[model samples]
Target: MKATDRTPADLLRSALSEDPARPLVTFYDDETGERVELSVATFANWVAKTANLLQGEMSAEPGERVALLLPAHWQTAVWLLACSSVGVVADVGGDPAAADHVVAGPGRFEDGLACSGERIALSLAPLGRRFPTPPAGYADYAVEVPSQGDRFAPYAPVDPEECALIVAGAAYTGAEVVEQARADAPGLDLTGPGSRILSALPYDTWDGLAAGLYAPLAAGGSVVLCRNAGLLDDDALARRIESERVTATAR
Candidate 1:
C-alpha cells in the first residue's frame, strides 16, 4: 500500500494514477459466455458515476448503509468502490429493510422493495443494458447512472475509522478493510503488481471480497472474476486459465 493510502478509495486512485491503461478488472460470465474487461480508467469512471448517483440522486449521506443485493460481476465491484468513495457503508447481502438505500440486480428486484429508501436496480445484462421494463418503485441504475457526472467529489470526507462495509453480519471500518486486504494478498499468492488472480468465489464473505476484489487492488494486481464458473467443463476451465494467464485462483 502507498504511504498516502488509508482507505480503499485511495487504493483505487493510486491504481488509476499508476497504470490507467492496464486491465484492472476482467469479468467473465461462463454461464453466458460473456467477457468484459475494464481498464483502471474505465472502472474508475464507472465508480465515479455510481458514486455521484448514490450521493446526489439517492441522497445517501456519509456513514449511511446501502444494501447490495448483487453477484460478483464487474458492476458489483464498481458499486463496492463507489460506496467507499462516498463513505457509504456497503452491506453485502444485507437485509433490505435495514438499509438506507438498496442496489439490486434483476434477480433481487422484488426483495429490494423492502427498502423504504431509494432503490436502484441493475439489469446485469451484457454491456449493462437496461431492463426490458423497469421494475416498479425502483430507479434503473443503468439508465440513471449514465447521466450522473463522470467525475465525483464527495460532499463529506470519509473517516477511515468509520464503518465502510458490512459482510455476513460483521462490520469492518475502512482502515480495517484495507488492512485485511493487504494481509490477505500474500496468503492468496498475489505476487505484487501484474499478478492475474482468477476468482470464482461469490462476494458474500470477507474471504470472497478479499480474493475477488480488494486483495488484487491492494496488491497492485488485477482479478479475473468469473460467475457460474462451476458450469464450465474442465477442458473449458483449463483453456480459460491458460488464455487469461491466471497466476492464482480463489475458488
Candidate 2:
C-alpha cells in the first residue's frame, strides 16, 4: 500500500477490529526470562491511552515531535503506535537531544540538548515513581498531566508524505541508503499469513522497523525479534525456525 493511502492508525484500527483477540505482541524478556503476550485489543487500547495522555496531559499538538530513547519492548511499540495515531511525529533514535520532548530511561544521560531547558522527563520502567527532578523550568511527566483511562478517538486523516520517523545518522548518506533500502524491501517474497520473520536487527533501524514490524504486520504474518544476534548461533536459530515453523527470515 502507498504511504498516502492510509495512516498507521488506520492499519491499527483494522487489526484491532479484524482480530481483537489475536496476539499482537509476543515479548520475551531476558531479564526475568519471561514471555508476555498482548492481544490486538489490549495493544490498541494502550496506544489510544498513551496518545490521549500525550494530547491531554502533555499538551502535545499534532505534528509535534516526541523523542523516544527506549529499547524494543511493549511500551516502545505502544508509544510509536500512539504517536502515529495522534499525528504526532515520533523520533526514534539513540540521541534524545535531537527531540523537542524526550522520554528516556533513568540514569542514562542527564546533560544533553533535550535535558538543557524546560524539557519533560517521562519514566517508563518504574511506572508510578517520579524522580530526577529537572533543575528549574522543566516539568515531571506525571505531575504535569492527569492520568486517564485508555480511550481515544481515531484521527480523522493524516498525510503520509510527512515525516513519521527520524533515525539518527549522517543525514545525506543515510537518507540515500534508506530510500534504496525501502525500495528493495518490497521486492522480497514477503507474503503469507503463516510466514514467520526472524530479525536480529535493532528496532531503530529502517530494515528492522519496516521488515521486522511493518512488513509482517502488513502481510498478515508473524515476526520474532531477537535481542542479541550474536548469542543466537545457526543451530539455535534453525531450531527456532523449525519449532515455530518460520517460513521466511531476514538474515
Candidate 3:
C-alpha cells in the first residue's frame, strides 16, 4: 500500500501487517550526536505500553484532553499515537491550565506542575531513562510505563469522527487527520512505498505535523525526525541523507 488512509491506530496496524522490521522512525539529535531507530514492531510496543498507562493508570478516556508540552522528539511522537489509541485528545503545546492530563519533558516540568490534574514527565533522556525520583507531584513516565502491560485493548470505542488532535487553534477528527494527509500527499510529492523523509519542521504547526509525522506514515514511508536540525552543517546533513537513505527532506 502506497498510503493507508485511516486513523493513526489503523495506520500503525497496517504498517505492522505489511512489515514489522521496516524502519518506521529514525531519530537524530544533532546537538548531542545521538541516533535511534525504531522498527514498526518496536514503535508499536512503545505505543501500547504508553496507551496502557494512559487508559488504565491515568484513567484516560474518550473526550479527555492531554496537554502535550514536549518538544519535537521520538517520545513525543509516541505520545501522539498513545493518545489516539486511548481515544484522548492530544493537545500539542496547549494551555496546561485547561488540560485534564499533562505530559512534559524536563524543560517544561515547572510549568506543567500547574496543570489541572494528572501529570506525567518524560526525561527525554537517552534510552528513555526515569528521573532519579518522582517529581514533586508528577509521575515519572519512564518509571510508570514499564510496569504497564505490553498489550493494549481500549475499554471503549474510539470514533473516527471524534476530535483526536487539537493544535494551534485548530481541531482535527481522527478521520480528518488521515484524510488530510492523503489530500496533501500528492501536493507534497510523497510518492510510492518505502520513501524515507528527513524532516526538521517543528510539530507545533499543522503543516509541520503533516510533513514530519503524517505524510510519510500515510505514504507507507518512514521519517527521520531531527531535533536541532539547524546545528547540522551541510556536510553533516548530506552524510545523514546518504546514511539513512533518505528520499526527501523538509526543513
Query: Among these predicted structures, which one has the highest lDDT?
Result: 1
Report the poorest 10 consecutive residues by lDDT, candidate 3: 1-10
* Off by more than 4 A, model 3: 1-5
* Per-model lDDT: 0.93, 0.59, 0.87
Order of candidates by TM-score, top first?
Answer: 1, 3, 2
Query: Model 1 off-target regions past 4 Å?
Result: none
Of candidates 3 and 2, the better by TM-score = 3
Per-residue alpha-carbon lDDT of candidate 3 for residues 1-251, written as tens digits (9 for 90 to 100): 42433588878878888898999889988877778999989999999999999998999889899999988888998999999898999999998889999999877888898797899999887788788887777999988988888889999888889999998999999989888877776666678577888989888988888877777778888889999989989999999999999888889
In candidate 2 the C-alpha lDDT for residue 46 amounts to: 73
**Pairs with steric clashes in candidate 2:** none
How does residue 113 of candidate 3 score in lDDT?
Answer: 80
Report the Cα lDDT for candidate 1: 0.93
Give one digit per residue, the lDDT tens place, for model 1 in 1-251. Answer: 48678889989999999989999899999778889999999999999999999999999999999999999999999999999999999999999999999999978999999999999999898989998788998988888988889899999889999999999999999999899999999999997887989999999999999999999999999999999999988898889999998899988
lDDT of 3 at 229: 89
Q: Between prediction 1 and prediction 2, which has the larger lDDT?
A: 1
Q: Best to worst by lDDT, what's the order? A: 1, 3, 2
Clash totals for all models, in order? 0, 0, 0
What digit string (tens of lDDT, one per residue) describes model 2 on residues 1-251?
22322555666676676677866665554444445566778777778777777766666666667777666655677777777777667777645554556665445336424543225555543343465664344455555444656678634444555556665542212223234333534454456455566665676776666555666555545566555445656897688768756667765
